[model samples]
Target: MPGIHITDIEAAINFWRERRPSADGFTLALPVQALASLYARMVFQRQDLADEQAFSAAAWAAWQTWYASTPDTPCIAICSTSQGDAVCKGCGRTESEVQYWPEMGPAEKRSTWRRITAEGTAWRFNRYAERARETQRSNAGNS
Candidate 1:
């Protein structure tokens, strides 16, 4: 399984910490502490101090929990695949990926998201990322 990003782990740690003081003696507190420790080891590049399998499992669980609140989709509504393009110029997903998106599992979708973002070849990420961000900011401000 792909590990959560360092930044995400950091965010999760903050999330847990913010709720920790009020969570004393609770079942969730132990897991939250464990997660924080594991995340800290990862951030400091000290994987040797922790079990990799354990860390992966904990991170995956934490990621799933966090992602439930903000499920992301890569579609920017300009799919070139609809016009018979093999790869979408907008989102960089292939025709098959676009067709199977609704059926793809979370891991598969995340893999595609990571690929597109890393490649940075799509119009969404390359040519219009700033514009998209600005638009999102504008929309958020209005809301």
Candidate 2:
């Protein structure tokens, strides 16, 4: 439910168009490409996806390689928002962002991630850089 975005679908379509183009103007793989295209159309045309689960699965398949390399959450097992900080000193998210994180779409999450990293005020961003890298490496190895 909280997976790929329309931008991701568009990127995949572009990649396929450039790297795996077909002579007949159809993608080399119709099913997944068509699914992603449908999702992109739904998003850009301001329509809801008819089947979110199916679309998520198809988008995951289409974007799995990129997904694997994406950064993990910025949380460092500490949350200052719960301790009454409006902007979390632990991870740099606002209280509202922390409260609504699970419901956030990929694009929203990425935007928050960018802001936190750029601000570099959170303990997780500044003091825990090595810890974050270690955790990422550990998670990647496990995967």
Candidate 3:
């Protein structure tokens, strides 16, 4: 998951599975709809590149905005991936949410991100946090 982190990816996949299994398979996987939106955004932002620097820059900018948000994750604490059953008790996301996350269009992706971020209020730091921490720690160690 380039645009999103692994935990978020797992959470999202689990979220979607609660509603229904994908037509193709029961186990949900990556390559969701939103990744395309990320690619498109990267291209649009002129940050699209196979290089590490491009990825670092894009990831940093994205993370900074999301992580600093007061609310973060907008999750109502009703996770769908719980063992009891499919479908989140709190959020309405389901298998489709997982399947569609990577391929969603820009508008759709933005909407999803907004919801996930709770309109810049809530932020979930899974991948970005790890990355930021590692970078800072490494930098400190180096300095």
How does candidate 2 fare on TM-score? 0.48
Model 2 lDDT tens row, 66-92? 444466577777898888989988899
Indicate which candidate wins on TM-score.
1
Which residue runs of candidate 2 sit more than 4 Å off their true CA positions?
A: 1-61, 68-72, 130-143
User: What is the Cα root-mean-square deviation between model 2 and the actual structure?
Assistant: 7.6
What is the number of backbone collisions in each predicted candidate, taken in the order shown?
A: 0, 0, 23
lDDT of 1 by residue, 99-124 (tens): 99999765567668768889999998
lDDT of 3 by residue, 1-143 (tens): 13343333334334434444566874332333333334455556765232323334544444333334323222455455464435433444454553465675333443455455553322133544456688999999999
Model 2, 95: alpha-carbon shift in Å?
0.3
Q: For candidate 3, what is the lDDT?
A: 0.43
Q: Over the full model, what C-alpha lDDT does candidate 1 score relative to the true structure?
A: 0.70
- Please list the C-alpha lDDT of all candidates, in the order they appear: 0.70, 0.67, 0.43
